[model samples]
Target: MNAPVRRRRRRLPLNVLLGLGLATIVVAVAVLAPVIAPFDPMRMAAGPRLAAPSLAHLFGTDEFGRDLFSRVVRGAHLSLGIGLAAVVAGLAVGGLIGLVAAFAGRLVEAVLLRVIDLLYSFPDTLIALALVAFLGPGLVNATIAIAVSLVPFYARVAYSLAVAERAKPYVEAARLAGIGSGRLVRVHVMPNIGQSLIVMATLGFSSAILSAAGLSFLGLGVQPPSPEWGAILASGRNYITKAPWILIFPGLAICMTVLAFNLLGDSLRDLADPRRTAPQRAGA
Candidate 1:
């Protein structure tokens, strides 16, 4: 018999690959910025103020003559940090509230739902802005505001998923077998919804980063002279006619990063649920 050829795996969408590649580059740049950047992110070049793209400064220099590339490089840390921290906070608050809402009687669900609704009433950016207004501007406060606002989203997602899982036959069987409420909820409900929770976290990360950067742009985030991407954008925006790269680079960075997570989340939605796979053909 002739030798059978192995089928090559299908190529992923070009956008997916590009997004992933860009994301990887951004991450590497962010993480290694300290070692890679030539000038201190804070260093102001007296002569290079508002300089455009050139050999000395790859991404060009801002109106203050601070190296735009270096600032953008360092700013990645602030943005990523806010996103990761906010998501972690969301996981803790939301996971607990969700667990309780799922198992507790109608009254508890009603109360949590009310709180969720109240939180949802405030637009996300507005809530963050208000909180920042009260707490005073800074990375920590901005992060807290973002995290608190995001908590309700995760809680609701967890609650709905848990409720669905609780109604499953296995859960009923466990209850009939005298499984305790705490253990039943923990053992049966959490595992089934874990994948969904992860998906939410990834999405939350992208949102949080964008929020943080936006806040920084408004001067409520990383603060002045720190070289955060948003702060850089804000500073360089006035000089857009002179040096557009300052705004362009950071803006693109934020856009690409957010898009990457979105694409990754979609891909993960497909991969995360094993049961979502198509039916297999019977062997001959």
Candidate 2:
């Protein structure tokens, strides 16, 4: 076990390493936006309006003459912040629901699962859109909408994990030994499922960011002057033919961010698979 663990540690896949590097860079940029941004993100006339990318302005200027680069950098804060907050909220509520359903009587499980099924049937974007429309527009509303939309997915994943763990012989032994359901679940089930939840959270984060951006693009998320990536995309849609840089740069940022998260999640899933890792373990 120790040899295999050390072997795995020493042989990180290239794509996983790249994913980590990209994610780290993005986080660093988001954290240091205020210091690293050349000009104020909200400042108008920071450069020539609709200017092309150049040394003076790396991502050029938007229609309002705001520095596109600074705006994109600044926008990272809202995108990442909302995504993280929403995923955490979704996981908490959804995980609890799943845990309760998994441990509860058959009637309760049936009812809870039906509701989860209903929510899971719809597309995430559609659910978020409806929620945002009902809740009214803004960053707070968008986060809530995105989080709510994500609940069913997390709930299903949690439920599956919990039920499987509950059926294991060790869990049966714990029950025979007079372990309370709550203690048993907390001590045994949760630890077993934690890694899966981490992978799900990583994947869900990309979805949350994408959903938040979609809301912003539809004028239902972070409002203007905030420099959110989706808002930037929306603002530049009209200038696609003339000032393409305004759209291109922000789009690239979103694409890269989402891709980095997906790569990380895939790598984690691969690492967690016993079938894949067992070979390496045996070889080691």
Candidate 3:
């Protein structure tokens, strides 16, 4: 029962440690893109048109003779930046609204639940597309759009966690101890449900990244000349028959990165929610 925590404190799974290290490296590259990238990510090189992978031009040259490796590296910056920003924004807004409704009472909870239901009825992609269309194309606007799409998911998760936490005897004890509703919620409910909110946020980040990339692929996000992953894919898509590496490398990057985050979120969610391991942990 205590082994998991002991393991975490002493030594954890190599995969988990390696995954964190990889994520950190990707983020570092994204942050230090201008300093780290070898060539101008945006500049088209006339001498290297459609060149295959070589020491001088790693990851090959795209149709426009642009450095494929440099753009992909820099694009990590755009995808991850927008993803973290949107997911954090969603978590902040949604977690608060959820906590408020869950603690308020029947009247407020019912109304808030109904609003969340309405948001849920719409497909997430639809909302993102609509937001980008209405707000016009830009990185900030696209981030906001994706973030708005993710709000209902976290809101629902937090609301559920709060409801269960409030019914616990400890929460009842707190209420009886003359604690005000606001302070009690802050001290008690928020701490208890913070794990669930974090798990939800990690997933929302992956989704936000994928959606933002889709928007960029369609020419709605970050705009051209920014060297986003999706834009790189878009630029080389037509050359798929002749130079597959152009599209394949960037596509693989997006897919693998999204998959890694999804796997990581699943593991963390398992670690955080004890109820998920009731049978296994109890037996072990």
Candidate 4:
């Protein structure tokens, strides 16, 4: 037991390290967009329109003759922000609902679970699209739509973990020791299930980013003139044959951001549930 524990604690997993490194770099670039961007992302130059990548324009110019590299750097701000915000909202609202429903009586659980099931029945993209259609298009509306669509997933995961935790002997012991219901949940239940939530949130971040991009691509998200990855991709579709750089760079950014979050989520899941070790060879 001691040997296994020591081995597990020896160093951080390679996936975690790589994920963290990539995520950190991307986040750093996003945060430093104002300082690092070479030119105004929105400013168009007639002379430079559709110029290829050069020393003057690293990622080249878009159809509008705006700096592609600068637009991409600035675009990270909106794309990453929306993704993180949506996931945070989903985790908070869904986690609370799950915990309350699981801890409350059967009637409450039944009602809440039914509502969740109803929401879950719709495909996530469809839900987002419907919400966006009703709410009208914009960054905030898109973020909210994406967040709402994701709530059921977080709630389901949290509910399952909370229900299992509630059935444990430790919870029974806590209750018998005169612990209040709220206190029991906050102190005993949440900590045990928090790791799972973190893993879920990490994975959800990637989903949120992808969903937001898709919505924007369809003109149901961030509008034009805004430096969003999806909006940029949509704008560049017309210029694909003439100037491919505009599409390639922003598309790569979205891919990289999603990949970073996914890798991080996988690493966190592995670390959280180390019990999922490979089966040993029989009679080795």
Query: Which candidate leads the pack in TM-score?
Result: 2
Ranking by lDDT: 2, 4, 3, 1
Report, for every candidate in turn, its global Cα lDDT versus the true structure.
0.77, 0.87, 0.79, 0.86
Give the CA lDDT, 0 to 100, for residue 65 in model 4: 88
Q: Write the per-residue lDDT of candidate 1 for residues 1-284, one digit (tens) a residue.
A: 22331111133345457657776887888899898887888887733787777889888887768887788888887688788898899778987898898788899988988997787666677778888989999878888988886777778778877888888899989988999879987788888888888876776778778788888899987798887777888987887877789889999888878887766665565556523432111110
Q: Give the alpha carbon lDDT tens digit for every residue of 159-202 in model 3.
A: 87888888899988988999988998888888887877787676
TM-score of 1: 0.87
The Cα error of candidate 1 at residue 86, in Å, is: 0.8
- Give the top-scoring candidate (lDDT): 2
Better of 1 and 4 by TM-score: 4
Instruction: Report model 3's TM-score to 2 decimal places.
Output: 0.88
> Candidate 4: deviation at residue 89, Å?
0.7
Error of 1 at 50 (Å): 1.1
Residues 153-255 of candidate 2 have per-residue lDDT tens digits of 8888889888888889999999999999899889999999899888888888888999988899999999997999999999999999999998898999999
RMSD of each: 7.1, 5.5, 5.0, 5.5
Q: What is the TM-score of each candidate against the true structure?
A: 0.87, 0.92, 0.88, 0.91
Mark the regions of model 2 whose C-alpha exceeds 4 Å error after superposition.
Answer: 1-12, 274-284
> Model 2 scores what on Cα lDDT?
0.87
